[model samples]
Target: MRLLLCFLLLLATTLPARAEVAGEMAAALREQGLTGAVWALVTPEGVATGAAGLADAGTGAAMRPDHRVQMGSVTKTVLATGVLRLVTLGHLSLDQPLADILPTVAIDNPWAATHPLRLRHLLDHTSGLDDARLWQVFSRRPVADTPLMQGIARDGQALRLRWPPGQRFSYSNTGYTLLGMVVEAVTGERYEAWLDRAFLTPLGMRDSTFGFVTQTGPGADPRLAMGHFDDGSTQAAIPWFTRPAGQFTTSAADMARLAQFLMGDGMIDGVPFIASDLLRTMGRQTGTAAARAGLPIGYALGLQIRDRHGVVGLCHSGNIVGYRAMLCLYPDQGKAFFISVNADSETASYPALDAILIRALSLPPVTPLPTAADPERAKWQGIYTPLPNRFDQFAYLDGLTATVMVMAVPDGLLLTNMQRPDRMLLPLGNGLFRQQDRTIASHVFMEDADGVSFSDGGQSYQRVPAWRFWLGWLSVGAGLLGLGWLLLIGLWRLVLGPRSLGGMVSISALLALMLPAPFLIWGQSFLALGDATVGSVLLAVVTGLLPIALLATLFLDRRRTGLLPWLDRLASLATLQWLTVLAVAGLLPFRLWG
Candidate 1:
């Protein structure tokens, strides 16, 4: 009788704890105005799954724990696992050069003879390849049946290396797409089919799929959650060219299984699926300058070492058009959590939920242990500018805005930028540095053949002389002032004097330069610029004619004599100088579409 009473008391307490957690999850969805959400929590005891809100907001169908949602780039973790499986089976090697594997693919690497592009480099995002271009990501054309090589060939420029492979880290969807091609070449089968049979099935994720799933398809499940925008409008799934990079649909229950596998010792059903050492390598970075300098935190293979609320975890986040998801595994604590929301609302409080979940799991906070400051920190102090942006099209704008100044302070080093709040980095010996409240080393300074450089894993920056930095900003300021002066003078002259040939040509040039401004300001979407639409074509034409019109004005109005004319001449000169800088930066005649 006493034992029965104890068991009844335990059940009573557990049920309400679960109910309280469910209430918190529902309130989180309501606060964000989200259509639906699914989540899973994995602890040493067991896995718990929950759902909140509507699966189909229009149909009023309630979301179920089994309903599948797009996992986006979290697919990379599965792809990397499969690659590691192939390595263990002796079918592939991580250090194998891409030139040996795919001889026909056009990979332009200047340092290929020495530092070859290897499989591990692609997996770790140190391949030096650019991310997908605009058309590659936003194309409306159907790619469901397109061959991997054919899709890659459409944007061949993305394959060119910006630097030597294995030198640094830069995220590249193109690189992973190439890895999918490698899987096809080595296994003699479609990547989707192979991964489905070898990976998803073995892990007991029976409800998950490796390819695109559409609404009301022959094989589509009615339980598939509808993706939503901030206004609760539904969005249909579109076929992506880079399927292997980010195109898996999975349920919360299935994600729990995957999370369990990540937290386990590489065994499935008491059989060794992959070696424990190999699994450990999946979360560690190697062969990069930062890694060589004893900085171990970065994008390792597919997982990112993230510090959330002073607790370090192996984490990955994914986002498609209207769906967003995050997975975090704290292996040391035997705890993991996965959360997905149907709506891509910026106001969604992901961090709030993360904190709540952490507290619920009783995960311990990481203690900060600051080491002595590096005596050689003075060489690392200066203004540094970002290099080799992930997208070449945005390089010019990023160059102007992403510069950071590193200063040696009494405690450690200070990182200051105009665009973001200041960060204080504590020394961690051997040129590694981390924030005061974080456990992982988040910054590193290194010297190479090119020069001294600093990296935060994803982006790298090079030190520049102070004069060059000031001169670049000065040129930009002068150009803007000159353009404004010319616009005001041209309008005043038109109102005051007869419209002469010189006046008209000068005005035309000024207007030609400023025509793209409205499109930039009032443009509906950046995705529209990816294709050959009417607006994109107009932008391309105007930018192409900018230099020619400016040169013509300079020649046609050279002989005009007056204060306004001379000032116009000077303004035009300054504009021309700025245009020259743009030309050197390869942004002239800016064409958004292929």
Candidate 2:
């Protein structure tokens, strides 16, 4: 006990306090089974930058604030500024429909409404477009089959209208891709090149660039801070086809400069980078408070606007497979905070970091939870769901199933994926709660005598009865068993009735078809297709059904019961083939709808 106290005291005293924020941040990563690199900057007058842990744990290189790391969705904040600059220049307008900008380029499946998706919708992420990707768009090589717009059109056309245009907010990466196209159309330049000329060059951001991972160059060091999985194993940098949406690389110094630019009212080094009117416009409320209440304030163009202790600020966060970043600017106080992690644990460091910055800057921090707000209390307990958006379900996938989680936190509640529990949401008075670094507005719960309903922004979900889980599984098992019984009965009929070889082939095909029948009947859009392969289907028929039919022939012959041995071998192969098909199909539901 003495040794334990001494150790604790030593740790408390020795850990970097302001710098220990990094250690606290690092500890947060470790607690969630994640490890990688972190670059954090808390600026009172100038930036105090620090790094903790490894850039590449496998290589033993210590993380440095100077080391370049992927900024993920932080790129969106910058790109949104660029797109808005175009809008402010009379090259585009927020009210103008997207169809007017690039008349020739089809948007694919446009929302059927009088008010088509506009530049405001794209910048603030109110566009109803389903998130889709064109892998070829971000490729260094020429795209052969799938073009970005074509894929958008194909998938977008099929998507059900989740919400009418601008009726409810939904974050769609596809919207940014559309905005990227607008940049190209208005500037007569490629999107990345325009970013270089408009945002990076003007701001003198020397180290930042977009699509470095996909673009061929010696520029992006593959040896830079590597992203890691929750288990601390390395994660490969994702190849982003939508560069503007979530792809950029920078050092802490560069990000700090960007933060300064945002905090400085769109000016850097005396040269006006963007009009101040444009900056304010970008931070303007695009969605209503009632529509997006749980949010800290509301989403601005590529930024979330909210007030901490009555100080209104603009902020944004980024996440890719292995990276996460948060950037904040307090315009009223002329202060900013930037934090990035190479191995993202999906923890909410923004709130903690915000508190630290406010304290460090001598500005009042956001109101802290009262001592009375015990997390252990039942009033703060219950399952809460976040607002509906594109990334909500996909953000949290369990082993092979998707799950909605309710966070039971002190003074606040969070509903998140099993994977990302750190996105804790605090009630913003009334039923509203904030999520996504407090940029998104949403509500927590609506209760009644029957059960609880989880709503975000405006959408609602009733509690799924517990029995539905078992009943679902039971139904699937019964379906598979029933198919098996049909197969056995068919085998008996073939043997007793002297069916022809053609009839036998037809029966085999039928069984092959039936093997996947259960999934097609009861699968989600993503799972119904499964990992189905034509070869697997063929194997199922040849090995399982054909042999069964042949065994029936032998049983009818009675003298040919000897052939049952060969029939048994075929039946075993058939079973193996069907099991493989079913296994692949089973895995699909977990991936898509889990």
Candidate 3:
């Protein structure tokens, strides 16, 4: 009787403390313009769940802990868990080649004879597959009931491998969708039904679901929170084509149960739901060169090994159209937390909430040991550009701005890039390095058939010659200057009386370049380019014709000897050179719909 009384007193003191922390998190969400948020924190002591703001801003419905929201890519974790469970049950093998599992699915892999795509590569995103293309993500038709094989056939171009399988890491939603297909291939059951029966029910996540949820149907969940944009506009629950990759709707209380199950010993009610050894393997990556070089941090199976405020944890963040979610698990310390916001606000303070929760739990910090400078740092200095992008359609833009320069500094190397601030890489020996602010080794330098390259697990950068680097920038500069000059000359000629064919060509070039600006400025959605519309069709036609116009202008004005003609010819040549670069980069004919 005395022990029971003491336990009750302890619980009474902790509840108020937890409530106070929850209040602070709510305030942080409001300050960042998020309309609604739900969070769950699980520790050895107990679990705390809370909600704040309005679930439906228009209807004035208050958010509740049981309200469901789109979990986005966090659904990958659940799918990966299902795959691992199959492995444990002897129904599948991680190293099994994808061709053996789905024989009819077309895959374009140059290394198929040697390094065939494997189940492990798909799970860890090292399968060399590109992410979803524009049409796949922004389909004009409803995707709620589209057959998996049909969808795969429609977007077969994304199945082309960018590199050898299991060579490096690159996040690919298409890879996860393939894994879902594998689940069906093996079990002869839909992935959603199998996952629900095998994992969700056992874990007691009753309110969570893996399929699309509607807003006005008889089966619609009234507890579903309405998704919001940064501008306070609401979004309807639209089904995604890649259902297994990012289509789960779950509640905070349900996520808290999942966190507890993940942090535990794979046991529920004294039954082994998953083998402890297999569960331990889910947090460590093994299919990449960086993993082979003893790098400890990366995207493993589903969760990412992340360092937050000096504490190492397994985490996964999710973002769909109008929702963002995060799940963080510190299994070593027996702590975990899940957070989601209805509004995909640019100014949302996720890091601030992370800090507050970390402080609240009093998690221990990690400090890296001091190491000697790399003796062979000179070999690592050079200009490097990221190889095949995650999205094939944007590869040209990525090559332009994502190049980086690695230069040797006093105690480390400085990584200079045009898009971000310079970062210092401190050597941790054996060709592995970490950023100055990071506690774990996150960068690896290695040599492959393509020569020396560096990787941060997700993207790899290959060394390029100094001359090639300078040539690329010079060509871009000359093209921009020529276009500006043409625009001015053409406008001046228009104001004055007679216009030459050269002046008309200049004006046409200017219009081609500026045609897509208004659509981008007003529509503010990449989905607009994914399907045939007036804007996209016009862009395709103009871009395709601009080069021909410039070439014709150059040819027709060749015999003319006046200063104006000569200058016009030179400008056309410059613009033509730029167009050649774009053509080589695969940007000509700009057919974005496919």
Candidate 4:
């Protein structure tokens, strides 16, 4: 009894000193303007966890080691871990065709008979499905009456493969969502439950949970910190039905444990949890994922493989509405780092902390991004389309940029981003480039027989054929002219009064609604307006009546004057041309009734 009392006093005294051990890391977070962050570092030597700033910005709660955070896409690692366990049991195979497993869900694979998408495609984000772009509107509350399977099936039917399977890397959350459904179909168990039993419980990640992350719920643990926005505004907690993709909530300590399991011998409490070899397999690059010099960026199964001066590491980064997270493991060093924060706007800064942890742990610092230019700029010219995405947003807008010109200038090239007409890209050698002085290494230039494959870091774009390229420009010019005509007619009506022009006010007003103003008025919020809204129905009605108004004016003129003025004639033609442009460019993203 006396020995126990003396040991307790000694241990309690040591804990506070250990908590203050990573003061340097806490200082880095403060320098980056992060509001709150929980970071845990595990090494073969020992484990240390540090958190700086408030756990809840609203309540001024001091951060704690056990505060839970939404894991965002890092949940993919957990999903992958569970699937690999099934693979070890002989219940599933990594190379097994996904179609063979989830037949109830319709997957639009044009080349399925030739190159069927295997289960590995889901893990690697190489499946030809869209990334569920429109479905982001369903983030908090999805469409009523739609289950995960139905949503996946509906999206699968609408989105065709942008490229052949295993062609190149294109991240898709829809693919991971489908993978979650596959897990349910085979085991007849819920994904979160299976994770808890197979992975979470075995790995001893007690704080991890799924569905909605909040301070209160039937199974709520209020130890989870409230999330905040970049502006220091409190963010309301929300649910994600897209389970496998983003429905994850965990703590730094629990994440560190998961990381420890990955780097360890795969035995916990003297029983093999998962094959250590399989976990290692999940850490390296897979399929046709490219590698650039100085920057080790490529996707492995559910992890991102990063190489810094040959110090290899497996990592993944994640984000929810108000929270962000990152986890990386260095097997060579027998070390792992996990950190998550409570603010959404500050999440991008979280990745930088990975480098800080690496250096602090005595590993090689991350390679500095390249800056030199490649003089051979002409080779970079081509008509590029956005990398195959589930959402047609970029494809439509970029397609209309009229086969964007990548012409060689004295120092660099002029490029169009669908939004900007011409932005100069200064070539930063090693097949990379940048748009502006303040930009990070933004462009990665890779070429093949199809054309030059270029990535602006966010989305991938490929060169298009000549004819389609010209059509894009023509369509864009027509759209601009059509918008100009509408504004001009409205101004003319304001001066001349609505009494003189018949059907002019209605047509002009309808066209103006098409410019996102109506969407803003009708959507639940500004962010929601990009897709659909309460006012979308009225907007769609106006759009549908547009051609009728133009045709009515055309026929009425045919019976009236002997000759029409050139401006009127051009206005009439431009209106008709604009509709054709919308159709050709595939910008019609919404249904009139829907």
Candidate 5:
């Protein structure tokens, strides 16, 4: 009894220090522009939990530690757990073909080219399934008749797979939605109902529930955090059908319980929720590189598996309407953190918040060291070809010039001369750079007196510099387009004076052709890069830009030639005729083509 008392006393004293550190971390976050509740739970034997920030901004109500917010796609982790539970029961196998489970739902693809998509493919997002424009279809449709599979099938029917099953990684929300359908088909119960029976009830996640609240009934918990838009306005509730992907509401305490259960050696209150080996398998690498963390990021079942500072991490992020949530567990440390906010202000950087959580846990900081320069930067310099839709390439000229026009990257900066404010060079080591903080990582040119290598994040990427091969081709295309525009402008001047109606009509025709031509042929490939897309879109918007000015000059101006009204009418007729010809000739199809 004396020994037990001493141990308890030691543990009690140690815990407050952890809490002190965690509290300081939270205070630092509040000091930044980011405002949201944070919950961190660390346990050696049991859980120590903490929460901070407002649950309601309007009322200034303090966020409850146990209040539920949308858990986002972290719901996928739970769904994957349920599926794995079934796998243990011998009811399903990871290799089971989708056609075997759902004969009616045809996953549209050329059937003969490869092996049919299996459960592993779906969970890993290597199923080669296309992403759905969920907001476009779901928000517009009646929720009842629009089944998950059908909604996916409709949108997916048209999209071509970038790769075959298990070939590479492509994050598809539609893939998980299909998993939800499989869950229902096998269990003969709705996905949420099965989860409730098999997982939630057993785990004692009492505050968590599926579907959006249609009403705040009597005695409802006032601590329920409201989701906020980037503009700080409250978001409307999403329909329930999308619940499996990210539609469930969960409290931070309940989410911590989940983290504990997952990190708790696969047990819940002394009972096994899942076998220890299966839990590890769920956290093992199942796919090619995932996007965010910049590596061959593993995905198993539904959760992302990553290793940071020697600790294995099981994590996911949830974003729906206005709500943003993230759950990360450092399983080796027996520590986990969950964050939920009523609103994520436009200025919020959730990943940075997660980084702070790591610091709060006293984990090793990702200290980026400035390595010495390599002598081969000039060898890597040139108009390296860029992969279509994958990367942007720029030739770095000088270090100081690169730093001034180029955003300061750690090693070097990504140099995007594109006009948008968001586009800039990001640094990679030894002077090579790549697009940083982007969805798809791209190559960068290094003029560090050392050669260039493909880079993402702070490390060198394994793939060869794709930008070098494709960028040359693109430059050629752009040069040709520029020469054509200049030639047209010169020809118009020689053929008719600048004030002539024919010259104006010809200029309008040239502008119409020039505006969309570059984007249709070239810019669409780079649209995935947000800043680059904005720059490209603005450059290509001549149709939206110049036509109105040309028309106003024709109609509103009082100075008129004797033939000017007739010529103006002729030009209008010509414009209509050109549009009619374009519609009938299927020239509009080029807009949809890559």
Candidate 6:
């Protein structure tokens, strides 16, 4: 009888808001080049849903309420809730050391003895694991969580923690993936199955599903929504084995129920899935990353805690390849909203829709920025990055961009990126600096060797000697000049004529060898790096000639005169210098053979 009632409720369009917002959002999504999207708003009274656009933009097929979209990292909320439920039952503990819980999975903590990874760290995105990597988990076919977990253990020995556990937040999908394995270990059931039994059934969510999903052809699974590209082409969903990190798919109505259950006591049909106490713990601030940095943002379990005037809003957003999702909860008002789009468009209408609904229906409007001046703000000026020694080769550029420069303005402090000087950050600050935007970014300064190190939320950066940047700029100059000189010589030979084919062979061969390199990097992200293609073969050839490329140039042009000699010298010098940079950046040393 209960199941029947829930099923009917899931299908029945309860309120008029469905047709209204659906039309509004669908029209808006089309303007943004999105094929389709669904939005669900929940209140203490009940749930209302709206959707618009098409499931298949190419085929012009209208989207239905039943269409499922990928949740991406939004899967974390469900996974964390499951883990917390176990904690409520005394089967798990939030503070329990992860190394102790999953003794079989190999995770090395350089701060092992003192600051080991705790269960809460996994939920809060602070398990010290490397954030994300672009690699596929298949050869013949997609595998199970156990084997993938084992690979994380085996290959992850070299991947160090980005920061000490609980020191701050650095969003890590690897940590969540390991947590999925922990669920398998604890309940003796796969993540997908356990989630069904725990939250889905009780909360009356029937359409949601998980695990690696693959489609051989377009519209292979019509029940599942295809991710639409900006060009109106659809991408068949691939098998994503990182189930815990992502791989969740659900309907908007079901997602709203999940959001409602999160802000509540976790009770359904007068039974508590997890105790009210534990549910409260999920909302309580675990780390002081935001508070200490004077940011309004706070993270509790898998949820990002935000501020609206004085009301607290628990939220999370997910974006992977083709889909985007945002879920916001206003506990004070007992209201929440979930918005997701099938197409990845920059001009998506969800953000504007969110603000409109959040203001008129949910929480009070946010407080406006104050006009106050601080003269002593000069004390906070410095360059800062993600704490000390957190940079690894795998995420070198990400680490470099984390660097921020603090400049004192007449009214307040301005934060700027050294790598992107054009960008400016106007932050709110009284004593500690904070962002006035929807995000909870905070900036704090601490004592350093030369000056103060600036910490933005979880990432810390220290002021380095200006010469370091000057050296990098010089390297860039040498690389560009050399490449241009060779290009000019190539054009001259093609049209004006080369004295010998020898000059053309060496220069062109060298260029051809390195041609596949950038493609390898792009393929690693777009496709799979290990996927053997013609480009991969050329990349291997480049790596084989890594040391000998410069040597051959010296031999070929050693006796030459005029521009040929300098061109060879400069191009070879640039190649060597660029190779050195890549090596230092950890972008080098990929599989060069087979």
For model 4, which pairs clash? Answer: 130-390, 372-429, 383-463, 383-464, 387-460, 402-472, 402-473
Model 6 agreement with the true structure over 230-254: per-residue lDDT tens digits:
6777776665546577778788889
Clashes of each: 0, 9, 0, 7, 26, 5
Q: Write the residue-wise lDDT of candidate 2 on 488-532 in tens digits.
A: 745875879655443354356446655544544544222123223
lDDT (C-alpha, whole model) for all candidates: 0.79, 0.57, 0.81, 0.68, 0.55, 0.66
* Candidate that beats the other on lDDT, 4 or 6, i.e. the better one: 4
Q: Please identify model 3 stretches exceeding 4 Å from their true place.
A: 1-4, 153-158, 216-219, 512-528
Off by over 4 Å in 4: 1-34, 136-140, 143-146, 155-159, 216-220, 289-296, 307-312, 346-355, 366-380, 400-460, 465-471, 498-508, 511-523, 526-533, 557-565, 589-594
Model 6 per-residue lDDT at 116: 83
Error of 3 at 176 (Å): 0.6
In the range 125-224, model 3's lDDT, one tens digit per residue, is 8888888777667755546777776555473643689889988888888899898899989989888888888879988998888878855566777888
Q: How accurate is candidate 3 locally (lDDT)?
A: 0.81
Worst 10 residues of 4 by lDDT: 288-297
Q: List the residue pairs that clash in candidate 6.
A: 384-461, 385-460, 385-461, 386-460, 387-460
Candidate that scores best on TM-score: 3
- Could you give candidate 1's per-residue lDDT for residues 1-594 as a string of tens digits? 999999899789766766777788778778767788788888887787888888887788898788889878888888888888788778888899988888889888888889999999999999988877777777665457677775575646426898889988888888888989888888899988888898889999888888778666666667779887888878767777777888888888888898889778889889888777777877678778877877768787788888878788888888887788888899988889887778777767667666656666778888876677688787789988877677766777766787889999877899998766899988888788887767778888988788888888668888888788889888898888877776787787778875557667767766775666667547645435566765667677776676677678778788878787788778878877887887777776666666
* lDDT for residue 543 in candidate 1, whole number 0-100: 68
Scored by lDDT, the top model is 3
Deviation in Å, model 1, residue 146 alpha carbon: 2.3
Ranking 2 against 5 by lDDT, winner:
2
Q: Tell me, what's the RMSD of every candidate?
A: 2.8, 10.7, 2.2, 5.3, 10.1, 5.0
Global lDDT for candidate 2? Answer: 0.57
Candidate number that wins on TM-score, 4 or 5:
4
TM-score of candidate 1 against the unseen true structure:
0.92
When sorted by lDDT, best at the front, the candidate numbers are: 3, 1, 4, 6, 2, 5
Which lDDT value does model 5 have at 283?
A: 52
What ranking of all candidate models by TM-score puts the best one first?
3, 1, 6, 4, 5, 2
